[model samples]
Target: MTTSAELLAAYDRQLRTDAETPSALDVEQLGPLRLVTFDGGRGFITYAGLDGADAGTIAGWVAGALGYFRNNPAIRHIEWKSRGHDWAPGLHVALVGNGFEPEESESIMIGRAADLAVDVPLPVGVALRQVTEEEDVRAMSAMADGVFGDPVSTATADSLLRRLSHADGMELWVAECGAEIVSAGRLEPVTGTDFAGIWGGATLQAWRGRGIYRALTAARARSALAMGKTLIHSDSTPYSRPILERSGFVKVSTTTPYIWRAPA
Candidate 1:
C-alpha cells in the first residue's frame, strides 16, 4: 500500500536525469533543463523540478531552450515533458508562446512489479514473447504506430534498431495472432534504479477488450521482476490507464508533452 506521494517522490528522485534518456545522442544543460538530442532528428526537454521559478523567468527559459535546439539543423522536432506536480508558474503560457503545442496528459501510474506480474488469461491463438531481431522490431514499431493512428514512419523503427545495438536492456514484446501483431509494448530497465518502465503500449482496435493488453502488461511485469526490479511505472493514456488502475497501480501524478516542429 504505497501512497501516491511516496511513489511520486521515488519517480522524481530515481527515474529522472540521464536514466530517462538512455538512448540520447547528446545532452546539454540549459539552466535547470536537460536539452536532449536523440537520433531521428528529435530534441527533448526535461527537468526533475523547477526550483520555484516565477512566470517571467520560466518564459525566458522557454525562449532560450528553443533557441538552443534551433541552432542544430539536424533537429527538426522537440518535446518538452511537464509534470503536473511541478511548481513552475506560467509554464503553459511560456511553452505556447514559444510555438509548443500541448499534447494529451497521461496518468503517471506506479506500483510494485509483483502486483502486476500476476497471470492474465490470454485469448486463444494469441501469444506473447520478447523480441530482438531487426525484422521483428520494425514490425512491432509499425504495428504500434498503426494502432495509435499514426502514419507508419521508418524513423521510429530505425531508432529502435539502433537502441537494440546498444544492448540497453530494452525488451520488446508483442501479442501475435498467427502473423499479425495485435498488441505491442517495450520494457525499459533503467540502470541503477529499482524501477522498470512499461512504455509505448498499443493494441489494435479490433483487439480491444480481449484482455490482450492486460496479458501483455503482465508479461512485461514478470520480466521486470525477473530483472530484479521492484517497481513498475507507466505514463498511461486514457485507454490504458483504467487497465493499470484495475491492477492496483496508483495515479501518482500526470504528465503532458508539449511538442514543437521546425517549419519545413
Candidate 2:
C-alpha cells in the first residue's frame, strides 16, 4: 500500500489533466499561477509551493489573480486550489481578502475502477439512467441542488446545457424513486488519460444509508470500465467518504476549494 502522501501526489497528478473539455490533464501558466479551465466556465488556480511569501507578496498575488479573472468575464467562477500540507503562510487570508470564499474541504479519493464495479444493491423502485433531454436535465439539476442543500441555481443547468451542446463523452446519471430524483452524479471519461472522474455524488438526507450512492457509483464505474478507463478519482466529502472507502477508494490527498464569486 502506498503512503498517504504518495497517494495524494498521484491523485493530484491524475486530476491535473490537459484536454479541451473538462479533462484535468492540462495546465496553462498565467503569470505565477496555473490556469486550469473545465467544461463549464470554471477556472482553477494552482501553484507548486508557496514558501517564503510574506503578507505583501501573497496579497499581491491574490489581487493580480482576481484582476485577471475580472478582466476575463467569460470565466464565470474560479477555484484556488490549496494544499494544507504545504503550509502556505497567510494564503487563505489573502484569498479571502480578494473576494474569495472558502468552501468545504474534501479528501482526494482514488481507486481502481474495477474495485468499484461490483454489483451494488439499490432501494426498491430505484433506477438509474443518463439524462439527455433539456427538461429532464434541468429537473435533475434542481433536485440535486435540493438534495445537497444548495439554492436552486440555473448556473448548473446552464452549464449542463452547454455541455450538451458539445455532446462529448461526459455523462450525467441519477437514481430515481417513483417520479423523484433520489441521487445524482456524473461520469467523466477523460481522453488521453487512464482516469475517469465521478463527480457530484449526492443523496437525500432521508435516504442516507440504503446504498443508493454506492449503487450509483458502481453504475458509473461500470460505464467507465466499458469506456476503457482504469482509474477513478473524486474529491469526496465527509458524507460520502466512508462509503467510498468501503468501496476500495483510498484517501490520497485533501483539497480545499477557495471560490471567487461576483461582487455582491
Candidate 3:
C-alpha cells in the first residue's frame, strides 16, 4: 500500500508534464514552466516546481511567460496552473498583475484504483456505459457544460473528437436515464505511468445526490484497473470532493488555475 505522501511525491515528480497534455499541439520550456499550446487557441502552463527560485525571480518568469502568450495572437486563452504544496512566492500577485483571473481552487486527490472500484448502485432505469460515437460524445459534452453552468461549446466537443481519433486511451463515460445523459466523466490513462485520471465529472442539478456520479467514477476506475493502472487521481471540485473522500481518496494538494484572455 503506497502512502499518500509517497503517492503525492511521485505525482509531483513524474506525472506533471506531457502526461497532462496528450493533445497539445506544441510544448515549449520557458524557464521552469512548460508553455503548451493546445488546439482552439488555448495555452497551458505547468511545471514540477520552481526549483527554489525567489519571489522576484518567479514574478519575472510570470511576466515573461504571459508576454510570450500575449505576443502570439493565436493564443487567446491561457491557464497557469498553481499547486498549493509548491514553494511559490508572490505568484498570486504576479499573475493578477499580468491580467490573469483566478478560478476556483480544487483538491488534488489520489488513491489506488482498487479502492474506488467498489460497486455503486445506480438509480432505477439508469444505465452506464462508455460512449464513442460522435453524436453520443457531443451529447455528453453538452450535458457536462450545462451542469458546469457554461454555455454549450462545440469547440469542447470537437476537441474530444480529435482526441478520440488519436486513440489516446481516453474513454468517455455517461450515465443516462432513458435517452438523457444525467451524469458524465472521462477516464484518461497516462502513458508510461501507473496512473489514470478521472476528469470532467458533472451531473445535472436536478439529478444531484443520487449516487449517479459515484457510479460513473466507479466505472472509470474499473476501466483503469483493467488497463493495469494502479493509481487514480483527479482535481476535484467541492461537489465531487466529499464523494471521492468517502471512496478513499486523499487530499494530496490543491490546484488553482489563473486564466488570461487575449484582447479581441
Ranking of candidates on TM-score, top first: 1, 3, 2
Residue-pair clashes per candidate, as listed? 0, 6, 0
For model 2, residues 94-167, the per-residue Cα lDDT tens digits are 99888899999898788889999999888889998888898888888998899878899898898887777776
Candidate 1, residue 262: Cα displacement in angstroms equals 0.8
Worst 10 residues of 1 by lDDT: 1-10
In order, candidate lDDTs are 0.93, 0.79, 0.93
- The model with the greater lDDT, 2 or 3, is 3
Please give me the total number of clashing residue pairs in predicted model 2.
6
What's the TM-score of each model vs. the native? 0.98, 0.87, 0.98
Candidate 3: list runs displaced more than 4 Å.
none
lDDT of 1 at 161: 91
lDDT minimum window of 10 residues, candidate 2: 17-26
**Candidate 1 off by > 4 Å:** none
Over 97-201, each residue of candidate 3 has an lDDT whose tens digit, in order, gives: 999999999999998899899899888999999999999999999999988889999999999999999999999999999999999999999998889999999
